[model samples]
Target: MASAPGNNLPVFYNDLIPLSSVDHAGYRSRTLDSAPFLATHHAVPLTVDEFVSAQRFLPIIFSAGDEPVPLALMGLNEGVNTFVDDQGKLRGPSYVPAYVRRYPWMLAKLRPDSDELSLCFDPTSEALGAFEDGQALFEDGKPSDLIQGVLKFCEDFEQAAGRTGQFMKDLKDLDLLMDGEVAIQVPGNEQPFVYRGFRMVNEEKLRDMRGDQLRKISQNGMLPLIYAHLFSLQLMRELFEAQVTQGKGPVSVTPAPEPAQA
Candidate 1:
């Protein structure tokens, strides 16, 4: 929740819950009251919506090796109900800077084909809507309060999602970072192997290289496609958690895995 000296901002999750209908439906029979719905379920400490909204953005920090250490966090009360304690109603601009408002675009650029991106930006869904709501919620509270609200949300998130699989993965990666690890993938050469490391010098040098050099380093596809899926799931979940802790609602829930079409 604390800011750095250079005004660099951290990532925060949005306040949108996943719909249950997205993940749960029996092909067999089952009577329905309406088109199946997405359930707003949380582990009690923090709802799924709260958890996901809180972890949308992945901060690009410099590792000891000068490599970009992608850090993600959640909790931004853009439209919070707000608690006023006198001082004549605290309010003003959002903690989210105007330039960073383009975060979604940046993330999109990282992986345009990402389903995670689609789900987060689903217009019909409540992701952006709830974010705006949190912004308005603390329209009259201290900026510090907004940050505090987010912090509380994340703390609760640690209790909830941190215990679940998807969330636990994110927490593990986050912990790695806290311990000075840079989560990165190394393309293998002469063999198909992916190496994810939390610590390594010259990491940035490896990341920044010409195609031939990069290809030579990754002839074996060091970074597997599965890494993308894992990153996406964890990253997406983190973004959503940011918003939820701020009192946002709505989160997506994956329908039960469908049986193979034999």
Candidate 2:
């Protein structure tokens, strides 16, 4: 259901095809030196499992929609990824979200009615296909060790995604999510660049939560994740600076949102 028609696959995926030994006996999985798909993409989905590591570098925000998914902002503005160059090469040491690392490969359900997910990959990826010199996907018409490892990784990612869904549900059930906004003032300008179009854990709600509610979430390890997200917002300014440094600032300045009343 996630994938739409006519090559409308997930982010970084141009086209997806189920992996099978019968059809891909000669296929090989190659090491990608660069990721062109990520060059222009600014936001990447993140799992709760990656909250701690991802918060150190990227601002984790929830997507603005009915099904809110956590996203690590590679850049504050759209199509302005400051971490990677135009060729999709990393410019500095940073934490790469597993969603990006698992790109070109994912476990997706092939049919709407079935719950069984199959190992699928983007056929357009330069790192995968019938390559002459790369890790073989199959050996003697059977899944090779390389395929086994890839399948395991995809499975783990799926599990993490499930946990992330539950995390979002918990936040919603507690009424802790609120529209997110960040205003960063430029040195020479009176008006700050205000960014919105995302959601964040409402710190006020969290603080005002009852004792038993707090204890329950804290014991379940949700407290730390919420704190990680709240703390990650501080990096938005850093991300904006990176965009300016990379000469990829937003095309137009947006008016700052009204400040909240104390």
**TM-score of each prediction:** 0.18, 0.92
TM-score of model 1 relative to the true fold?
0.18
Worst 10 residues of 1 by lDDT: 35-44
How far in Å is the alpha carbon of 110 misplaced in model 2?
A: 1.9
lDDT of 2 by residue, 68-113 (tens): 7788888866677889988998998999998888877877778867
Q: Highest TM-score among the candidates is held by which one?
A: 2
Model 2 scores what on Cα lDDT? Answer: 0.81
lDDT of each: 0.27, 0.81
Per-residue CA lDDT of model 1 for 216-236, tens digit only, reads 435633223223212433443
